[model samples]
Structure formats: C-alpha cells, structure tokens
Target: MLEFDIWELYRMMLRSRLFENAVMKLWEEGKITGEMHLGTGEEAIVAGVVSQLIDGDAIAVTHRGTPQFIMRGIDPVLLLLEFFGHPKGLCKGQGGHMHLFSKEHLIAASGIVGSSGPAATGFALALSYKKQNNIAVAFFGEGAINQGMMLESMNLASVWNLPVLFVCCDNNWAVTTTTNKSIGGTLIDRAKGFGIEGCSVNGTDVEAVWELANEALSKIRNNGGPQFIHATCTHLEGHLLGDLLLRHNRDPVLMAETADSLKQYAGESLNEVLMLLRKIGGQTKKKGDPIVFIKKKLKDDADRLKLIEEEVTKQIDQVVNNALEISKGGMKND
Candidate 1:
C-alpha cells in the first residue's frame, strides 16, 4: 500500500481537471461570457496552499482562482451553475469568471488584475486589530507585482506585521507578455524592499510548496511579519480562453521545449504528457456521456427549489437577527 493520502490528492486533481474541462466546453458553446483564465497546469499550487488553511481563515484570490476556490470546499455543481449564470450560484449569478465569495468562510475572490493583494492585506490588518489568530492568504499572478496597489499592500502588511501570506503564481508569462520584459527585478527582491521574508519555490512540486507554506504560515501565526512566496510555475495552455494564436510569430517546437511543466515533472518525453491528457480526456468524456444527468439536475423539482430557497433565506435572516441582538445587548445575558 502507498503511504500518504495520494488517492485524495489524485481525486481532487481529477475534479479540478474535470471542472476546468467542463468550463472550457461551456466557453466553446457560447455559455460563459468574458475572459476565462484556465488554471490547467497549476493545480498543485492551489491544493498545497489550501491544505494549510483553517475553516475560518480568509483568502483573497485573483482571476485565476477557480481551482483554489474549488479546493476550498465550494461545491462543483454550484460552481458549474454559477458559470452557467444560474441563481443557485455561490454569488447568486452576480459574479462570473473571476468573482467568487463565501461570506460564512470569509473567502472572497476578485476578477480585477492585481487587486486581491490589498484586500487580503486589509483583511489581515483587521484580524490583527481584533487580536484574532486568523490569517489571510492572498493569491495573485506575477503580473500583479507590477501593480502599485500590490506593492503598497506589501509595505502596509510589513509595517503592521500582519499575518498575511502573499503567494505569487508566477506562470512566466502575463497573458503573452514575458515576465522578463514586464516584471523588473526578482520577486524576493520586491519582498525584501518591504522588509518581509521571501522565498522562491518550485510551483509544480506540491510537496515542496506544502512544506514551505506550512512553515511560513506557522511563523505568521506566531506573530511573525507577512511572508512572500514566489512560485515559478508554467502555463500549459494559452493566456486566455481562445486557442493558440500567433503561430507564425512563435515556434511551436521551441515553445513546447521551454514551458511545459508536465514534461518537467514527468521527466519524460512530451509523448507521455499527450498520453496522460488523452487518458484524462477519455475518462471525462465517459463521465459526461449521460446527458440525462445534467437534464435531471436542471429540471429539479420546483417544490425542492422553493424549500432550498426558503432554507437559505432563513439562514441569512437568522445571521442578521443574531448580529442585531449582539449589537443591542452586550456580551453577557445579565
């Protein structure tokens, strides 16, 4: 028997892959509008980071946050429904592509480029001010480092010595703009400028990321200042929703040789990756064969829908009522 819960990890990775593939299909069929940033080869990063989080800890995510949010216990059906613009979405269909929020868990994500950093820092500051042990993790892309708000947030986070973990998913290219041309200096150097400890790790290695993140998080929980981790990963697909363009401008062989993480991880030929992709694609197709599955889900009983709606409403009402009661009466019943 194998050691460690490899089965669970494999299952989660499979689920993430299936979810992204389904979303791509929706995008192809003209269902999902707006830009779709697929986190194809970056599943390891989300899994590693989320494994360290407690139930109530907050997370601020960027546009490429679907995998992270899904890994954080968000239902796959609800996520799919959200992508399809259904009322049963996490955000009630208001947030598409990049906006996902769960108030109960204090988990919020944004679509804006490089915006989550500041929001995460603010959440951490609030936690510090309240003297709570809760920590906040901000997930952003390498492109975000160029944003002034991200830099400012780092400065504030360091100055306040907040319990915030800044994770940089440096996928090398920011929507086709090479990081070399766009990001000046190193990611660790930027963190050093803010007087925060920083490290650059291999993003594709889940074990490495998990170990490092755990140590960093432990330090932060002990009143250590904010930490920065630059995960240098690769993007197996194009920058966005569409198929690869600019074929003439780029060499396929060279590109394949350079940025494919699957090949790097497998330490094998590209053929191995192609075979694995084929296997995954075949299994996914089989799982989605029964159209009745989706049809039945879509045609859920009206009474059941109403009951669910009522339950959700009652929950919201109870929360609001409790808040009002706590505000009116102090901490003690006497």
Candidate 2:
C-alpha cells in the first residue's frame, strides 16, 4: 500500500470539510447563486482516492467534485471565487463548482454525466503513448455508471491496456432514487466482463479506499492496464444543496446528534456556523461525517487535531472573505 502520513490525510479531509461549510454559508447568503451540493459526508472517498495520486497523474471528477479539487491541492480562495462566479475562479467563474480544471495539476472535472470516463481514457492513452509511468483516474457517481458511455470507456481502457482507474462513488442514490432500483448486477463484477480487475470498499473509510486505490495504481503503473474501485459512500444532503424535496434516505435524528457533537468545536461568535452545521447534520442519516469520523479516529491526539481544525477554520474564513471582496469589487484575476 502507498505509505502516507496519517496526520496529513486528516488535515486535508478537515480542510475539505471546512471549505464545504464555507460554501454552504455563502450559498445560503445568496452569494453563490446556483445549485449547491456539499460532499460533507463523502469527503473520505476523495481524500483517500486522490491522496494516492501524484504529480504526473491525471484525474477527471464528477459534479460532486469540489472536495476532489481541494485534495488535488487547488487553492480554496480561487475555488471560492469560482463558486461565487468571480473572474478569479479556477475557470474564471465560467465553470463554477462542477468544472474545476488545472492543467498543471493534471486535473479536470465536469458537471456532465459520464463525460469523465472518456476523458480519462484519452488521458490514459496519452500517458501510455508518452511511455510515462503515470495513471489517469476517473471519478463518477453510481448514477453515472449506468450511462452507456461510462461502460464503453471502461472497455476502451481495458482493450487498449491504458493506465486508468475508474472510481464509482456509489452512495446508493441517484438524486432521489436508490442505486439498487436503478442498476443491475454488481459494479465490481461487471468490470470482469471488460477484462479489468475491480473491488468494492467502504467509502467513508478513507484509509481503506487509499489502500485499495494505491494497490490499483501500483498495478496500473507497473503492469499497465485499467482497474476499478467501487466506493460505497454516504451523502449527508440532497443531490442538490437545499433540495429537501429530493430527500432520499436522510435521518433527522442522526443529523441532530451530529449537530450536538459540534458544540465543542464552535468558537466564540461562530455560533452561526455551528447552527448551520447542526441544521445540516440534523437532516443527514449517514453513519458518520467524514470530519467527525476522522476526529474520532484521532481521539488519542484529539486535542492537537482540534487545535488544527480551529486554525484551519480561521484560514478558510480569511480566504473566503478575501475572495468575496475581490468578487464584489469586480476585480479581474486576469
């Protein structure tokens, strides 16, 4: 497995959570005018999967991909500006949250369905042609898996012996519908038909996803071919943020308990933030929030971790304020 610093993993996950929380606040305040989707409970999958990828690697992410962008080392200030439709965003405010691209980082995300799969195949083909010891990863939800192009791309990757990793972030729901109702057979099993190795894991468990992804990356790099990681994760909110009507399997009680757990994390005058988290958490039914889950894992050093979170929260707040000021002032990044 890829050896990684556990604390760094925790730090990145915490940062992703704080950033999402910031976006939620901005969206509620009518600053990020559009559909908002926060991957609060699903942060681990992105953290785990992306941590295993390095500089030369290429990645294509789906609509619920801001966390993936954060894990890829994109600056949150720029991303915030982009989310706010400011010219300073990663795509200069044109792409918003769904499309974050950085050629230097070899990363791209699309708001469209099943698009990343083919995009990844093309990247893998390039990497192979250049004889580079790099892999391309495509991340999509279970709903996208049903798309014909998605499966076709997997086949293309396998037939070409391309170094590609397909990560199906299966939260079991396609918007308001469950995956079992929409999909047939198993994701891992179906990959065998395409002559690619596949496995499923607990998406909330970041370490597990990292370990599996590391193994797949190693095999792809050393042996040359495609592989799959089917991650079964949880979504704490609707497919779209503030979409109560599309509520699928959320549990108000669990969310309330999650809210209670945040009291100690709240600082003076940050009660609004705490209240926001609590309100969102009350609607969630996931077994554990990614940030809270990792905090529990680091319980032995909870004091230090908590301090780190406080520091991160401060940084996020500062960056967000700066981004908003720049956006509101009509300052151009160009």
Candidate 3:
C-alpha cells in the first residue's frame, strides 16, 4: 500500500497550476526575463512521484521542474525570487529558473538536458559507498532517453547496483519536435537492455504513478539497485514563451492540431483544463480544471475542494505580489 496524503497532493498540484499561471502572467507583463517553459499539463506525474519521496531521498529534476521542487518541499516564494534573479532566491538569484537547489530538501533542478541521469547516479553511488539506504531519482524527459550520457549513466548504475530511480516524463515532444519522430524504442525496453527493471504508468492518473513509484522506490531502498519509469505525460503549451516562430511560421492548422493532440495526451477531462488555459490566456470562459478531477476521485466534498482552492490561491497571490513588489523595488532576493 502506498502511504500518501491525498489531500496534500491535491493541494500542491493546485499550487503548481496557480504558480505556473502567475509566472506566465509575469512573463507577458515583461516582469520576468528569459523564456518560460511550463509543465502545465504534467502536474499529476510530478506530484505523484515527488510526494512519496522520504526526507533523505534526493532527486535531480529537469528545467520544467517547479512542480517537483514544490512537492519536494521548496518554498514557492524563494522559487519566485530565483526566477526573478534576486539575490534572495534559493541559489541567491544566480540560478534563475534552470538551476534551483535546496540542499535542505536534497533536491536539485538542472538546466542541462540528460544531466539528471548522471547526477542522480553519482548521488546513489555515494550513498551505496556510505552504506546508506537513501535513494536517488533522476527526472528527465523522454527525449533525453536517447542521450549518450543518459545511457552511460544507466549502465554504470546497474553495474554498481546503485539505489536510483530514473523517471522519464514522456510528454511526447522535445520542445517543438514530437518524440515519436525521434525516439527509436520504448523506454522500458531500453532499461531492460541495460539490465534494469522498468515499467510504464498512466501519467494522467496520479494514483497510478504514485503506486508504481512507491513500489519501485521501496525495492531500490531495500535491495539497492537502479530502476526506470516511463511515465506518459502532457506539456500542454509551446516549446518556449516566444514559440510564435513554431506556431505562427507554420500552418495555423498544424498548431491547432498540436494543441488538440495534447488534449488527448493528458487527463481524460479537458473541460477544467481548457477553462484554466482560457483564464490564463485572459479569456472569460467558465470552465473547470484538473484539481476537480482529483477531488472527485478522492471523494472530496465541495466544501473541502473550496477550502483547498482558497488556501492555494491565497498562497499563490502572496508569492506573485511579493515577486512583483521585489521586482518593482529593484530589491535583491535576499
């Protein structure tokens, strides 16, 4: 049985959605620098896997990993400061969005592709040498599965029997290009080729991912070895904030088709997601979102859902306003 706090998971997932929406808004108002890459539709996968991690367990996440950071216990306000390049950020604003590290949580997010694979392997190897039971996790995208560094890391981890878990967030596309156009084999099969155990889970279903992750992590914690997870997910938006080149330079029909494809890639219910996307895009369409799905699945009452929403929204508003205030004042993140 998986030990998880369903209520807490849903609350954090709601926070993730709200925070991402705020970041996008800041970008549009020219309040933020650099391109914004969001994992708007992949909340379930990140929350599911991260919420189950223990205190000593560590993970190396990708650039689109704010949700993972939050679930792993990073302060959203500090993350906002980091994105604002403030001296008060987790890395004193030097890391920006691509590099976020909270040693307290034993979690780090990198800007480099496929870097997490080797990073987590190294961590696990150190744990093995120390005779510690702590496990390491590498959170990468399906696109990086083909990277030589990733393969080499997998081979070394398996050979050394390091306690590590490789999580492949299969969002189907590497930026603007589809993964199907690139990846040659199923990710689990590749893990098998490296003599590693692996499985695929429904990314849209948080319970499913949590169940599989619990099993895999427990096995690694007790037996000491590497594992892999090919979690199907949805990225929901463009490659980058100024992705107009890909969407506009191409046929409008192609762009619409791509958006429609993501509709099928994520949750079964788009009524809520489309509604939130419209709101984020400044449209006044009355629609629901993924949090509703979680509430319904968990049998949470309307009162409980309202409480969660109000609490998360309150926190989000505070962080967004504080970030903007800090930016306006030219204050450092400190």
lDDT of 2 by residue, 1-334 (tens): 1476677888888888888888988898998888877777778888887888877899998888888888888888889988988777888889988888999889898888899999999998998899888899998999988898999999999999999999998877676566757888988888998999999988888878778887888899886599999988777766788775333125556555655786677676357544444444444654656666777788999689879889988988898888877787775665
Residue pairs with colliding backbones in model 2 are: 255-281, 255-282
TM-score per prediction, in order, is 0.72, 0.87, 0.84
Model 3 steric clash pairs: 87-333, 88-333, 88-334, 272-288, 272-289
Candidate 1 lDDT over 251-318, as tens digits, reads 45644554465455665655644543343333222222222222244354657545544554454345
Model 3 weakest lDDT span, ten residues long: 279-288
Q: Pick the candidate with the highest TM-score.
A: 2
Candidate lDDT (C-alpha), each:
0.70, 0.82, 0.78
Please give, for residues 90-195, the per-residue lDDT of candidate 3 as tens digits.
7898998888898888888887899999999988887778877788999999878878999999999999988999999886667645676798877889999999
The pairs that clash in candidate 1 are none
**What would you estimate as the lDDT of candidate 2?**
0.82
Worst 10 residues of 2 by lDDT: 244-253
lDDT of 3 at 212: 91
Cα displacement (angstroms), candidate 1, residue 264, comes to 38
